[model samples]
Target: MERVEPKTADDAGARADAYAAGPLLNCLIREVAEPRPDQDGRRVYRLPGGGRLLRVRAGRRPAEPEVYAAGGWRRVDHAELVKLVSDELRRHTGRANDELPAEMIDSRETLAALLAARDAATAPDDPYLRSEQCLVTGHPCHPAPKARGGGPAASWLPYAPEAHARFPLALLGVRADAVVEEGDTSALDALGEAPPGYRLLPAHPWQLDLAAPALAAAFADGRLIRLGATRHDVRPTAAIRTVHAPAPGGDVFLKFSLDVRITNDVRRLWRHDLLRLRRTDAAAAAAVAAADGPAAWLSDRGYRTAAFAFEHLAVVVRDGLREHLRPGATALLAAALAEGFDGNPLDALSGPAVWWPAYLRQVAPPALGAFADHGVVLEAHLQNSLIAVDADGMPVQALFRDAEGVKLLPEVSRSAGLLPEVSRSAGWERLVYCLLVNHLCEIAGALTERFPAYDPWPAVRAELARCPLPEIGDLLTSPTLPGKTNLLLRWTGADGAAARYLPLPNPLAGG
Candidate 1:
């Protein structure tokens, strides 16, 4: 087991502080701070509202933060950094968020705790599992990525996927009369036998714990029965709420309702979202299937939830990677590729010349084809996308998951319409942000970090150029791309899922 404990010299606090500062600094730089003249090696940025000068060792991961104070620069630790951010946001936005400041602190502390726990915790042998467990930073741009509903550490630490936690799902027997289901959820039936007139419903135990009091009446009235845990434990993927389990019929993945707020939304199988999962998943799957390559969609098979505990007990079955992956290829989480792991293919890259294009070829066309031909604007973000690689660590296929994040066009289906879905323009903006800014930018940053001599974007331009999609015309020529403003959004107390964009220089239109 590769235990990822913090090094003795850095200590837990220092590692967590550095990890915490990166996202915060990135957010500050992107949303509020304006770049000043570079002084020596320190990249200095001035806050617009107060003309406050902040300097840091800049790169993909900024560090050694300092704020200009008195006459010289004063060091700002993580805690002080949060205070600095809160004060600036209040000045910049003309609004003060009582909650976000605390969340910023909580996020940092949570990372520290996760670092200590992961260091002591034994890593899973499965490289995929290790990759899934590797998102200790979670969201790269969120102000409070790790705030687990602002609850106690004990509540979330035990089930944290980042700590390499794996446990069996809590099973419940819903009375046949009370079981509400859609599509093919027969997969749940094979998990465990539910006495004579009961249907098996798997629930995230943490969710069960959160919703237990509400379910007391149902349990008492025999509407639901406690059927114990699954025989085999399921490993949580990077999504945290979704878990991967190896079953008799190959491998299967299950996504569960988690009441806690993860990054953007409450990590629940929301009643409305669940009601439409089948239709959304079907649209995405068909779009991917229509594309002429190894690209695949991990279909959200179906869901089963008790009528009374509709949102609380919901569980959606997702297709496993085994059937979709090409022979002799293994799938790795794309975010893991960006954040790095024990064996990230990006780390071993000799140069970007060969590696970059192969990646673009495997990743770009499917997403472009889906939008151009199939009206499916995939949330092709880092976390939702996976890259399957061959024996030589070359990307051979691109597999995307999470139908919940997917957007469908009005033309895609009017009768079975995903009504109230984002507009085509809105959807395209999201796709550009998710696909280009969030997904490709990080990977490019990673590759460029190692092979700075080689420019990765000309090849990105060429790969995207290969796509016959007309939108590529503007995209390749566009001067600016939309960058999501997380710091400003949270500071303004806007909904996390709600996007606010700022113009970013388009790398495709290189100097």
Candidate 2:
């Protein structure tokens, strides 16, 4: 939020002028509403006209709001009050002052600078190690030992027998207290001499608060080796201890949460079942059943579940292509496809194509069958998908995340059938919008922009053929679009050319 500071009276006047011309011109400040306590245990004022933007702590400092006109004590509009309060409060209570060098602003720049600085400061010959620890249990590698009662043998236990057999402890977050007077330096040296990937990072000061109980338990149980200077301070949010697995060319990203929650699809499975039940225990039972598949899969595969069982689970990091792709790419791509093809592939293409029959024979029917049988709502509109290429720059896979958006088959709905009063019309319409417009358009747009030489429309057509998607031409030619977002296609074969257009209501839209 930092900007070039106003240097002179002229500069200040210019900034003031600019502010008036900005979006805040029409906004009015109604009044300063009474203070209300917030989640962070701080009292904040709700300014009437400025929406629900909560005010920050003003404290003993007489912070003044920037007034538009030079009026001594007049009623201020909401927008002006917001600007004033923000500036004054920010001045009184500074934000986290962790400013990097001016040049390291963007993600790429920050990454590059941090990498260089870390390389220069550390041992020239040593490898880089990043470690994290969970706060719930004090163990350096979390899902703490207490949380994983099976002791060291538990799947998620950092030092599981399987780990010791293959993956050497390359990077370790030595508990600050674990390093005693004997000096933890020698142990570091021992690790350094072991292998190429072997390296260690000092635990942050806040890690002590995290690992305190674990250290105490280890000490009482004779598991901890007392060394010199065993403890360092650590902040709660910033606390973590990490140990690296001994492996080459590994790009694993691990996330540890203080709260135990099943994440992603796993959580969805439980949630869906919870909504099925009328009572709490029945809901709990359903959730347990939902977790069975994943838990059993992990157990059978020997993929260690950390000692501290978390409600949420993290996935192993892959190529991370989706990280760079912006949202809405998919929606754009779909719209592009719809525009390119005049609905009928046969009519749109002038060239004789043999693959069209193959598409009809092999792909379309089966895709539709799979969706119906598996109750899978592909919702393959643009935003939910990514167009990633391999080293050769050929699109290889479509990575799908965000399972929350995926709706189950209607058959799976409760006996009540998706809630008696559920806004089915609105919900269905939004689904259509999400699939046809938002998701598809963004992706197709990006794809076309990137690969002009390659026409991706054919591929989309093939996909549509595979699913029992109504022919685009038929949908456009027919009069009615069943949903508000124009997502549903009603087919009419009788009239040949002239079809009607009707709108459908969004299922989720409030009537």
Candidate 3:
């Protein structure tokens, strides 16, 4: 990919600041601050730790952040905002974090680079590809969603989905004796051929580069052999490590272990997760099959890797859209629908009344149904979801992927030796957070942004009421919803898997 300079350094910096500040402000307000009366069309929040008043031009994306200083309110740019947040969090949590603030800065810098690169790069002709690559302001609630491991722009920009990148996979041959795999990974052999004693393995070039040092001895020995790159180019999806591979028979997705910290964790296909993948994937597939709708589960069929470098080089083969998608319906990332994109179906709608209901009918049922009927809990957040729309741009089907995040209620507890009650409680909380808070809220906000008069919560409540789950009644009347505390979680240096949530005012309560 080639790059051109932004219109001006100042303009790019300001835009990056605006982009970075929104999520940080959202985190600050949601996790700690107390809401105050509106001031001059801006929402005022009191930072309890410092007794300081902060205000922002509030909406789906908050902007123009200002803090009440010695006398009057003063504007804070991204850098200053980071400082303010760090101070407030330090006071609020009584914890010190040097790393998060750096990531906050890195995220802004990364955004600026992405903004410039996106201007120069050509978007893919495929609408799905465009939607996958369209998340410039990713994970609207994360404090540093754009942070690229705090690495140099050149190091990551080539493989960045936001840059509209597509590249051939780096092929390698693992010695047959060293190859360890589970389930159906026939897709790997189709990528390229290996010598008589070796099996074909495809690797992400970026991950290959990152893991080169660890695999130096393996390369020196007969365990690993380098084959050339694949003939076909794979486009990186919103989940940066996963790529959409177009094949002669049908398109497939390849997910590789990326040794980078994306949002909450280092996005490596861990050995433990891989070992249990088949069970979790099988459970999710069964749940989807039993669900009452056209909703599909894009199963992670299998994975292949060298036993020596399992986590570093593991590649998961996932089901593609062709077989599951209904004819004439276009499948798009749900995240892309929330984060506007060119050729977005949502943009074509005149109002949210028709589109929102159709969307709810398609998306809400499968997720809720799977949990109620089956013991499977899906990580059905925006990125993991795909909403297939018909000719008129109304949602017709819902497709979800990422089995690595799926949890089976009693099964997970039995296998992991955890308390059944604890497992079930945690699983339900995660489902609620991912589905209601992270996914539905975002899509609803997007619809509300366009149709100001349209209140989406009533439709959401009605849809939940339709579900047979006994939990629905309490959920509809709950005073608060679980909102993941990403900022606080990172600040406290907790493991990414250890999710902590803060109670957020529930809109469904009124409905």
Count of clashes, each model: 1, 80, 0
Cα lDDT, model 2, residue 54: 42
Note the Cα lDDT for every prediction shown.
0.85, 0.27, 0.90
Residue 122, model 2: Cα distance from true site in angstroms: 17
Full-model lDDT, candidate 3: 0.90
Return the lDDT, model 1, position 277.
89
What tens-digit string does per-residue lDDT give for candidate 2 at 291-406? 21211000000011112211111111112222333333211111222222112122233332333233223222322332334333433443233233233222223333223234
Model 2 root mean square deviation, Cα atoms? 19.3
TM-score of each: 0.97, 0.30, 0.96
Best by lDDT: 3
Judging by TM-score, tell me the better candidate of 1 and 2: 1
Candidate 1: residue pairs that collide: 5-119
For model 3, residues 123-145, the per-residue Cα lDDT tens digits are 99988899999998898888999
Winner by lDDT between candidate 2 and candidate 1: 1
